[model samples]
Target: MRRSPWATLAVLAFAQFIVVLDVTIVNVALPDIQTDLHFSAENLQWVISAYTLLFGGFLLLGGRMADLLGSRRVFVIGLALFGAMSLLAGLATSPGMLIGARAVQGLGGALLSPAALSILTVTFPHGRQRNIAMGVWGGLAGLGGTLGVVAGGLLVDSLDWRWVFFVNVPIVAVITVITPVFVRHVAAARAGDRAFDAAGAALGTTGLLAVVYGVVRAEPAGWSSPEVIGFLAAGVILLAAFVRVEARAKAPLVPLGLFRSRALSTSSIALGLNGAAFLSMFFLTSLYLQQVRGDSALAAGVHFLPMGGAAIAAAVLSTPLIQRFGTQRVQLGGAALGVAGLFLLMTADAHGGYATALLPGLLLFGTGIIGVGVPAQISAVVDVQRHEAGAASGVVTAFYQVGGALGLAIVTTLSLSRTNAAVAEGASHQQSLVDGFHRGLLIAAIVAAVNIAVTLASPQLTPDAELIAEAAAVA
Candidate 1:
């Protein structure tokens, strides 16, 4: 049966949307989750970190699996696991159960997201078709995070917090039923043709998980603490081992040579920096709106509507901008805007009203997000070989996840340290919190500025007309 390319895109995009949405949806429901689960303040953070650590850790392996096992097969399997875990999460009566379910949910996302993206890369021809498809995919990726906040608010207010997890069941059910009908399966690699680098996979996955775990733990434990230092050192050693293994392996899990592509490496770095700033923006602003401004969860979500709208608009504009100015220029421009937005946010004060102070910064930050995000995503895979698309996508996604974790840890630690100092000096609690948030916003601005510099310095940002032509020809 012939399947429409657009139909394939729809199925893939929907899957990506839900996967990304799950990342942020839990944020708004955290309070309720803690209350119901009787979670300690320290343990509460695991509800999120558990999911993130596994997701980032397994992403590369997931991408390779997509290539080895077939993208459609991996996608279906991932969706099934994600849906089942969502059910487990929603029915959980204790912190242990919910956190355990969340960890598996992250694994499902790791598999589903890359497979879905690899499918899109194959299904759509390069040039205008791929660009447009990526525009929609990138736009949805941004929208999903924003929408999760809104949806989480509504669901938590009207129903129970568990609805946030339960909501996935119906959506996943619909997508799962329709996916096989519209998405064509790519042929899996022959078993005899290539060796599966199990050693490389183990080293890389453990390395990433160790790094993410260390970063997450650093939020509660100081960076110099034994646990943080030990995990981080272990991560670095394991990753180094993985690189050595890849160089000698008959069939390496990650082709280290892919880093030679200036486009892929530079864009991956810029994306990581952007992820750090953008994800932290979401985290800081949500805290600012609720903690400092005294807004309810619902109100905070509503306030973000402007930012979401701005992001959607910027995403729509990204394709045309890329065509006219090229991906590099657009990305640099986006990073600049992000820096400007962060600067504006840093000016926020406890006394200021949301409309007066928060709205403009949110709008600019949101716009900046799509500007950097869409171009970075497109550039990550644009020059890669078709067969390596899954690996390329995984590298990009891994950077985004790890960058967010690392960046948030750094920013949060700095902010909280400052806040504690202020409180010790007898500052009001609200003022101290606001001051800390501003400090974090300042660091976020610096990160965005660094991204701009990186983007500007990369020669691969130049348009490759021949590459696009070759891709289209092959398609």
Candidate 2:
């Protein structure tokens, strides 16, 4: 199963693009989906939530499965499942059926996402080549959300909303067929550790599921509601227990030792902040465009185009920056750009237009965000052992997912609260909407600012630094 690494990266990166793409593509198609499928207003949110929740919930488990079962095997199975679920989701006759299919699709995504990264890390090793591969992968991932909205709009307009789901079918079909032939990587790198830890898996998975569920429900149900409080409490306790179990397990589902690496742990925290700031910025900005500026969904999506372009450019330049300067310095510079971008976004007025209000901030934010993700991701896998690569990937991915959930909950609550307060004070509805948006975007900016400090204090290492260290040790 030997193959070219570049060929392997293309296959893996495309699979990842679809997974990230599905996250937002469905949002544009939601109204169409609801109208045709007779979805009630309340249950409509599940169309997106079900996939994200399950996908986030099972990431660790999926990563472990890749280690236990083998990346290639899990990859093929996950790809097939994802493709079939997409077909089922597209052809769904009822809301319940579509939700069910999406839930399964989430599991498939959970499996595939990490396995792809696991294979990439193992295939490329960690160096200049890895950075370029990651640059390509990260660029697609960052753009996927923006493209999803644009693509979803086009799909729903030119074709049907079902095409959003249907589009993934042929892509995965091609990848799945050529995967065994082209993705020459074999079983988990940790081939000798055959032991399983069922207890850790149950506790950790359920803990994460409960936490994500609580955050998702918090905005709609109120954070203080019994349901939210109960879920959050249970999640905290379950995760605590899971940690205890992992500490004692001879074969820990997630090796507690992995966190001992300053690089991995710091990157995990940094990435969580990255997700909170960046993902919520997208959510809030979309609302600003549609609610404040009165753009159509398609038009609102079009506004992200400039940001997407800046991001692609930044992603391309970042690898060489990492090669010369190291990940920590690059990440710090990105944070500064991101903070400046967020601050600029805060100045957006209720009466401002696209060129006057959003374009500047969006361009700055987009450029900075590419800087945010690329280095942290590169840092995350630094010195990670081969066998546990999947699990490491899962850990960082899960943090980002949960961070997004938390960020959305925080900003949305702040926005609504601010808007309500403004309305009570007799502000016009439009003014209140603007006030609320600024409040949320400001909070996102603050989060990005905090990351600058985090990146500055964390471990600093790059491919060249490692070589220097090795040479020094040999000398």
- Give each model a TM-score: 0.87, 0.82
Clashes of 2: 0
Error of 2 at 12 (Å): 3.5
lDDT of 1 by residue, 364-448 (tens): 9889977887777777777788766656767777777767766765676677777777889999999998888888898888988
The number of the candidate with the highest lDDT is 1
Per-residue lDDT of candidate 2, residues 1-475 (tens digit): 4589999988988998999999877766766787899986335556765676667667777767777888888888889999999999999999999998998899899889877876886788766777678667766776787698888778877799899999999999999998977797566646577566778867876786677667656756888999999999999999999999999987776678989878778877888888778767876676676667766667766778888889888977876788799889999999999999988988888777779777999999988987877777767775577555545666777777667655665666667678878989999998998898889888998889888888987777776645432211111
lDDT against the true structure, per candidate, is 0.80, 0.78
* RMSD (Å) per prediction: 3.4, 4.6
